[model samples]
Target chain A: MAEFSLIETIRERCAVARDDVRLGIGDDGAVLAVPIGHELVVSTDTLVAGVHFPLQTAPFDIGWKALAVNLSDLAAMGANPAWATLALTLPSADAPWVEKFADGFAALAREHQLALVGGDTTRGPLSITITVFGFVPAGAAVTRAGAKAGDWICVTGTLGDAAAGLACVLACEDGADELIGRLNRPAPRIAAGLLLREVASAAIDISDGLLADLGHICARSGVGAEVCVDDLPMSEAFGEYADAPTRQRLQLAGGDDYELCFSVQPDRAPALLWDLAQSGCAATRIGQIVVGREIMLTDDSGAQIEMPLRGWEHFA
Target chain B: MAEFSLIETIRERCAVARDDVRLGIGDDGAVLAVPIGHELVVSTDTLVAGVHFPLQTAPFDIGWKALAVNLSDLAAMGANPAWATLALTLPSADAPWVEKFADGFAALAREHQLALVGGDTTRGPLSITITVFGFVPAGAAVTRAGAKAGDWICVTGTLGDAAAGLACVLACEDGADELIGRLNRPAPRIAAGLLLREVASAAIDISDGLLADLGHICARSGVGAEVCVDDLPMSEAFGEYADAPTRQRLQLAGGDDYELCFSVQPDRAPALLWDLAQSGCAATRIGQIVVGREIMLTDDSGAQIEMPLRGWEHFA
Candidate 1:
């Protein structure tokens, strides 16, 4: 098939409602309207084969993960996703493959209420880059630098399901089907993020492991944190893996969780958890920011535990 | 180098004014603000080596062309280029090559008053994907479906220079440096697009050849067009190449022109051209809309020109 035909097929398959999209995939670009009083939050992420994902992963999962990760970014900022543009490069225009990928992509996009605004389809090694946009009220979005020294650090949902999921997949472990699914389709905490917008002093989604991501908040806010190991939230599925120490390590440093880790004033922390539970998000008080530059883990007796501070590095 | 270090380098090198950039690089994603009263125009283009450009093209030209092409999309919408996010895939991080590419990209972006808002770098065969955003007045964007029959077709600047340049490079013609530069760094006609927005009934950037791109406008608008061969604009540089017949063939049906093709009411066409010329854009009326479904070209003696309607098609 020709390139134009491929684009035409994609346009038809990815259609949600072309009305909100002033221009879709057929034009030079797309035009979109930003409703009054809402600011646009723009974010771009590129997932390359063999780097961002394993080569043998299903195409649908690849497509779902590509858009989901970007949506996570918008969610971290407490913005409502509105539009997305995809720049796709593939070894060839495999029609069946593209159809499945687009179906997977459009399903997630439609579920999130995002319009497929515009995109480029090209020839190259498989890579998918999505630039996502969301709307947030001016000055209401959260950032990493707003954490205060006295703020309580909280996290939504399980901390290390995705990390444990990867381990299960790598080991090909039996009875680990649910764990592997978490790695493939980690859910972004959109509702919790929206609910925490008014209360979060600082926020970031856990993609680079909880410890490393929290370190970002620490470096930006010029404060240290003491995380209570006993307060860590781990999925029951993770317990089927190695031992307690291994699970703790995964919770602290294993990445790709897609859960929202945030800081809130001490007064708002308790109510926020109840609010999060109502929204189907489990909340846990992981730590507290303090006046220092070190990130430490304390046990039940407030004794610091010695462990390797390893995090996922893209090109380590 | 690690991906985090690579991103830190980009964050420093691609820095522009930070007033409208709520967040730059190095986060899960960047946050940016689109100013009030302006609708956002978004576009993404991917340039793969051996596909978008000649294999031996200069790094600087490649960088310039990648961003310039996306800007042309914004220009076609009568939008002002504002923010851009680049996703670069390279075999490896070649230090000198990366520096030169960044310099070229920064220069073009700075000249257009566009900020390098955010980006990602990854390892792969050399390719660059840029997602660009522009701002236009709400509900004032120029789209392809707005043209009406009986409207005059006008194109800003000359077409065919880039095509001729590509030919020169392919034929290894000596002393065709200027032609080669036209292919390498074609101006996007952004200012002209903004000027034509109010007057143009419909418009599209001439990328997939005039016939093919205009066909897109016609198909979307449910109209047809009649182009006059005698009125087609060719640069003096293009005239120096193949005979008039061949020149008309290649120029009219060649891709990568990047000129703006637009429709205007015949009554408003003359004034639009005059206004465009005053603003330093050399526009020429090349055709008119018709009441049928086919694109036809007539020569000076009112004889129909029989020509193949060939244009660029990927994956053909």
Candidate 2:
């Protein structure tokens, strides 16, 4: 098949009815209306085969994760998903693979009502680059530089599940479908993010582990953090599969959770959590922002705990 | 260096002061205020190392061409450039190469006052994906679906130069600096596009040869076209380096020209040409849109001319 034919297939499968999109897939550039009083939030992410995921990962999962990761960035910014463009480089025009990939992408896009506006497909090694655009009310975006020293640090959803999931996949373990699912199709916390924007002072998505990502908050907000190790949330599957040390390590340092780690003032924490729960999202308070510019982990008795692993860096 | 530090390096280098940019770099996403009464125009393009360009192409040229091509899409839409996000996949973190690449990208960005908002760096074979966002007045953006059968076909600048440049490079021919530069750094027709927005019936940027790009307009506008082969523009360098057959082949089916091919009504063509010339962009009337859905090329005497080469199609 030619590139245009593949693009036509993707367009047919990923089409969504959106009023704000003036022009969608078949244009040199997509024209979109930014509703009055809204600011645009943009983020780009690239996932390469073997480097970002296992070479054997299903095409559907690859498509899901590619869009999911970019959506996660929008979620971290407290923006509502609107549209996205995909730049896919493939070894060849594998029709079956493209079909499955489009199916995976379309499924997630439908859930959020996000339209695929425009994209480019080229011949090369297998890789997917997705750039997501979202919107927030003007001057209403929650960035990573607004945390105060006395703010309470909170996170949406469980931590370390994706890490545990990766471990399971690597070890060829059995009966770990839940963990594997977490790894393959981690959900973006868009709802939680929208709610958090009303109360959270600082926010970031955990793609490079809790410590590393929170460290970004620290550096950006000029504040430190103290995480209570016992307060870290873990899934039932993770609890059963990981030993104490492994759990601690993965919970603290594991990447690809796609959970929002944010800071809220102590006064607003209860109300925010209640609102999140009402919105069908469970959130947990795990730490507090402190004066020092370092990330510290503490146990129940408040003793500092050593980090087990460093965060994943693309090039180190 | 780690990814974040490298990002910091890029942020420091590509940073441009813009009032509309609420937050850029160091965040989960970039936030920008879209101007009121305007709509957003978005486009994406990806360039792989060997597939899109010769492997030995300079990083500077790679970066320049990547952004240039995306900007071309915005140009085709008659949108003014504003912001762009880059997703760069590199085999290794060669700081010098990155520095040069950023320099090239920054040079063009500075010319148009386009901001580098956010980007991703990953480990993979060399590839660059750029998503550019521009703005046009509501309902004023030119699209490919608006051409009428009586419109006159026009193209900005010259053709065949880039293809001839590629041929020179592939043959290791010396002293073809002009041709090679055309291949490495094709200028996007931003100014022409902005002007054509008022006069052109439909528009597209010529990247995949004029015939193919014009074919897109035909497919979208539901009209056909006839190109006068003798009227096709050729640069001095292209004329010097190519024989009659080579020139005809390259000019008729060359890729990477990054020029605007648009359609305008006959009554508006003269004024539009004068306006374009005043704006320092030379445009040529190459043909006319016709009633049918086929692209035909003819000599000056109106005799049908056969095309020498096919347009480049990915994954064909």
Candidate 3:
């Protein structure tokens, strides 16, 4: 069979297209029509070998995390993912690896209902980049510049699990597989974000550590924030791999948390909290948006706490 | 400055936005409002180290070609270029290389009036993947399945220049810079495609060589093709870089042409040719869609000629 036949084999068994998808694989390009009154949201992420993940990492995890990160970006914008395209570079045409990778990718894509539209595969060092598209109504999508003073700052689920997982990998700690799995398989807060779209004024995903990502929202909205160091959420599973101080450090400075961090107006916070509770979402009031241009962390006794301005810096 | 900051620097310097761009950089996701009566077209491509190009290849060419190839896909679909997201991976944070890559990318992006909505930069063996988006009115875009028996097959510009350029590079042949440039900076036939949107019945970009790509259109449209070997638009520059047999090989199977291979109905052929001439487009009828299931080639005297299938293949 020719290369096109090979592509046909892969595309047939890959991400299934939805009815709304006007076109799919085996064309010059895929065509999709967004529903009326809905806006298309797009984001792209690239994962490189040796830098983003160890060479020993599973191909399935790599595919899953690649899509998950882009989905997290969609969640941060309060958009529902509808489509995605993957650009994969590999060392060779390995069948077993492709099967596992497709399994991981299809599982996450099905869960999120994201149809795979088009993609390209080429010979190169192992790398995966995914470009995802989502949809939301006009003027209703959450943004980074919509936050205001006196807004309740909230975070979905927990933070630092991925960070803790990375730490376990770096330290070669025992029972690190669980943490590594968390690092490899991040859960994008799709439902929570869609639910909070109306109530939240601004939102972002925590991938560059809580402080850094929060700073982005604050800077964009021209408001400061005060995150209570004590209010931060963590999994007890983290403690199995880290000490208290290490866990604190990991939670504050480690990156790759795909949870949504959002700001809700003080007046709407009560109803939002109730709705979140009803949905069984573990939403936490981490702090409040302040008037000034500085991010401060407060202790359990309401005392100010100091920490380094450290996070994942690509250049460094 | 950090690598992320470097990316931010490029983003700020090349800040491109239009009303259709509902969201740009600095947001978790980009939102686009496709104009009414239009459908979105999407394509992605990936280039890997030592596979797509030589390691010593200039970073600028790499950047240009990455976006150019995707633009060709949109062109083949008879779509108007709109937005693109880049996923770039590198071994290290090389400042000068990054600057040049951005420079080449921004220059081409500005020329095409395409917006850099969003992308991600990460560490790994050097590779670049770009996903491009375009818009074509509903029911108007050309596709591979529109070709019909007795339709005239046409191609824009020349072929084999880029492939011969690669041969020159592999042989360390000097004075083939023009051919190499063609290889590195293949022009997507956007203008020709736009002009042919209403006239052409089926189309595809010549990436994996003319025969292979046209074979795709034939299989999809359920039509055979009779290409005149004498009519193949082989660039004179190709001969300057390779010998007779080598030139014929490049013309037959060497890839990276980025030209539009389209089919036009017999009656509409005259009007289309006139329009292309008026637009100063270099296009010619190279073949005819036949009623059989084979891609046959004929000489000037109408004798069938046998040729090798030599396009780029992932599983070959």
The best candidate by lDDT is 2
State the lDDT of candidate 1 residue by residue for A55-78, as single tens digits. Answer: 777778887888888888888889
Using TM-score, rank the candidates from best to worst: 2, 3, 1
Task: Write down the lDDT of every candidate, Cα atoms only.
Answer: 0.83, 0.91, 0.84
lDDT of 2: 0.91
Candidate 1: segments with Cα more than 4 A from true spot: A18-20, B170-173
How much is A292 displaced in model 1, in angstroms? 2.7
The candidates, ranked best first by DockQ, are 2, 3, 1
Question: How high is each candidate's TM-score?
Answer: 0.95, 0.99, 0.96
- Model 3 reproduced share of reference interface contacts: 0.86
lDDT of 1 by residue, B21-105 (tens): 7776756566677777777899999999988999888888888899889999998989989899999888887766776677777
Q: Would candidate 3 be rated incorrect, acceptable, medium or high by CAPRI criteria?
A: medium
* Pairs in steric clash, model 3: none
In Å, residue A140's CA in model 1 sits off its true spot by 0.3
How many pairs of residues collide in model 3?
Answer: 0
Residue B200 displacement (Å), model 2:
0.2
Winner on DockQ (2 vs 3)? 2
Return the interface RMSD of model 1: 1.6
